[model samples]
Target chain A: MDNNGFASYFRFSNVDWNNMWSATWETVWMTLVSIIVVAILGALLGLLLFETNGSSSWGARILNWVVAAFVNIFRSIPFIILIVLLLPATQAIMGTIIGPKAALPSLIISAAPFYARLVEIAFHEIDHGVIEAAQSMGATRTQIIGKVLLPESMPALVSGITVTSISLIGYTAMAGAIGAGGLGNLAYLDGFQANNNAVTLVATVIIVLIVFICQFIGDILVKRIDKR
Target chain B: MIEFKDVSKTFNAKEGQVHAVEDVNLNIPDGKIYGIVGYSGAGKSTLIRMLNGLEFPTTGSVTINGTEISGLSGKALRNQRLKIGMIFQHFNLLWSRTVIENIEFPLEIAKVPKKQRVEKAQHLAELVGLAGRENAYPSELSGGQKQRVGIARALANDPEILLSDEATSALDPQTTDEVLDLLLSINKQLNLTVVVITHEMHVIRKICDQVAVLDAGKIVEQGPVLDVFKRPQQTITKRFVNQETGSSNLDDTTVVVSELLTKYSNGVIVKLTFHGDQAKLPIVSEMLRQFPDVDLSIIEGSIHQTQEGALGSLYIQLIAEQQDNINGALEYLKTMRVEVEVIKRG
Candidate 1:
């Protein structure tokens, strides 16, 4: 490799180091908060889906249909479209439609339904015999869900969360297009529009690094918890 | 006591309604190990699940200790189930929990304190011979060991009644015997009423005092284990008994009888089924001593033990100088209460 060619490709003189660091922090903050909130909401929705659809007598059939329809509708819409569609609600919920804080509402709304579907699949993968064993032990529905269903499917649930978190990282970048203030905004405004290739390259490399780190942690945790 | 009073279960399928269980009435007395033996699709599982209210009867009530379990729901049903513990064929110990935790699950649901739950689980692990492997997960255990955990878990609630749904069906022969022995000991020590649903007749013969043979969702015959083994009234029961005793099929036995008849022009082929003391008596030697001129050759014989006593069957060909001697020998065998059948005469 020629030294001059590599130097020109990674020219750092035009990159604003302070702005890049702040954008990286903003991306981390938005992804982290959105992931935690989605984890909770998604797990609850997933469990509701599992119990209602798993048994005919559990909860109301119409309630199951309604929740299912809502999840499906949210999941079917593209993330970019969903962000635009939720602009009015986001302003009402957060008092502004800009910056990382404002972007969180749409990010959570989009990612939660996606993760809920995965959680439902995880719970469905647990052996029916295990659930039946709990029932035969005189366990109430709540006990069965907490003691059997959740614990038994923990590994899958954790893996699903990891996938959701990585997906949220990508969504946070897209949120930057509408002034959410993250690496995507820095890349779009300072790198692409300003014709600085080095800033965009660094931002893209950091996003890839975050995804890899999430995948590694997810694989390790899955292996640790999956006793079966 | 568990009583199924005209119970029936029907499933609504796309094609039509499938009758899983039909008008079944069974009385299982207390402090006894009862076996419900049947082939696949015989509704043995459906019948047993009713005892714990896991599956309710469509038409009739299932009375356990005089409480109709069929109408129970929610907390009432759960409270009723607490008195009846069940084990499964697959030994469904929670894969996420250790053996001890699995055993403590029922106690936890009962809201027993953590300390008491641990103490009781330890005691149950020892009782089921899973003492040293308390922390081991179900994935690490072998099939028999997994089943030991299952048994310990079922007994953790101090239930008076235990239901075993083909608990040994997934185990190998040796492991099946070990599990069955553990169940037998548990039944005797705790005086727990155990209802075992199995396709294997040997499982019934090994531990059950009473045996009910089900076929096509109905109990074709049921009685004391000895009675069912010796005098199986239904064709399915007879086939199960034959399989258990290592006896030849009817066609093979008939062929043997026919061959003996052609070879010995003046011989008698008699099938003698022995029960209790009759099985131990030297009937053949005694007959030879009584009639010196008669020579008897054993064709086929098998003996097995049930909860009742030793039961056996022997097919013998008696070649005598006179037909009257064979007749006298048959009469003497009948006097001893041996079911004697003359299969062939020449």
Candidate 2:
């Protein structure tokens, strides 16, 4: 394309780019906040997955079954459906269902359980023998969790977090489906409806950059922290 | 001092309730090297793990140094564990850490200062002859070296009690001896009490000051190494002693020669022990000079030094035909109290 075509398809002015920077900041804000919320929430729920024991007790079995059913129910529905279904819940909590800030609670509620299950799998991969050895060494349960289990399973945990972060980025993009103003909404309302290919191309580049940055940082952190 | 009072450990395996250790009460005196020997699943490993509170007894108490470590909890158990160190059959050196770092782990967990931890690890690495290879990982070292690192790691806490669970079972014979020698020297230098568990009779016969033979999880027989060998009470003990002293897997030629001695050799068949049983050199020549026409012909022999003392077994054929002369020879041999076994007629 000629420079005229290129300039028409892109936001080339420095001041114009700066003017739209709030949207960019909101996208970053949505992605980061949702990830933190979801990761923490999911990790906690995942621990519940491992701690339940229906097999050994009737009450534990019943409670475990109910929790298992709940986790699976949340995990199976599509994220978009989850967001739409959470509209009432979101409005109840936030007094509005349309803004990015109001949409975050649902995004986190959706992502947390998914990430938690992943954390459970990572935690289970640690050798029972190592835990037994640590116990035999007189390490307390807390010590075993801190000194043995966490340190031992950190590589998988980091990778799990990487996967979660990348997926959460995608989920944040999906948040725009509900009029949440992230790059996805920027593409939808401005780029698609307004026939502005500039917005579409910018949003695509931004999403790709977010994924690459998440992946590279995850790689570097795993390399640095994992001894095994 | 360690005392096991009627201890029994039973595990609920999928197969069934496996009695890993039956009623076993043993008194392991302070500063003595004790051996609990049995085949795999005979409860040897479980017996030792119990002493360090790694395995709690099902039906009895284990008192160590005035404390019943049987049910010690959390911080209390850890504090107890700091007083008892353990080494495993597989070495169990943390594969990620260097030899020095691995050795320093107990100290590290115990929160010993970094400088002291390093110094102690270095000293222990030197003690086990891994001084130069301190920075090497477990994967880089030989099986023997890994075990040395394990020994050093077990000693890092300077525990009064060292529990070895088949510690030398994985190494080559030569390396096993080297590790055993290192343990012996460490035992002497540190005056540490040691309890080793193994399926190998040679391990018990080589370094145990006192030994308990566990058969089907019960202490079938136990005593000083020499006493147990010379006068075994249980049939299994008899068999194990025979395996250690009666016959070695020498060439067929030696087996054939032993058969020949038992078949054709006459007079008095005597087995002479060397400075091999448990202590000083016994003057066997002075005892033998007492016999006229004794004509000692050695048929088979072995020299092994255990922790108690040096032990030896020598099979010799004697020359005597007359019943009176045989009786006299027996009389003379008994005076010296040498172990004599009748071979064959001349």
- Lowest summed lDDT across 10 adjacent residues in model 1 chain A is found at A1-10
List candidate 2 segments past 4 Å from native: A1-27, A38-70, A92-96, A190-202, B13-16, B93-145, B231-235, B238-297, B319-331
Output the worst ten-in-a-row residue range by lDDT, candidate 2 chain B. B274-283
- Judge the docking of candidate 2 as incorrect, acceptable, medium or high: acceptable
lDDT of each: 0.90, 0.77
| TM-score, model 1 to reference | 0.96
Error of 1 at B219 (Å): 1.4
- Give the count of colliding residue pairs in each prediction: 0, 9
**Model 2 residue A135 distance off true place after TM-score fit, in angstroms:** 2.5
Candidate 2, residue A40: CA error in Å? 3.9
Give the fraction of native contacts in model 2.
0.28
| Candidate 2 Cα lDDT to native | 0.77
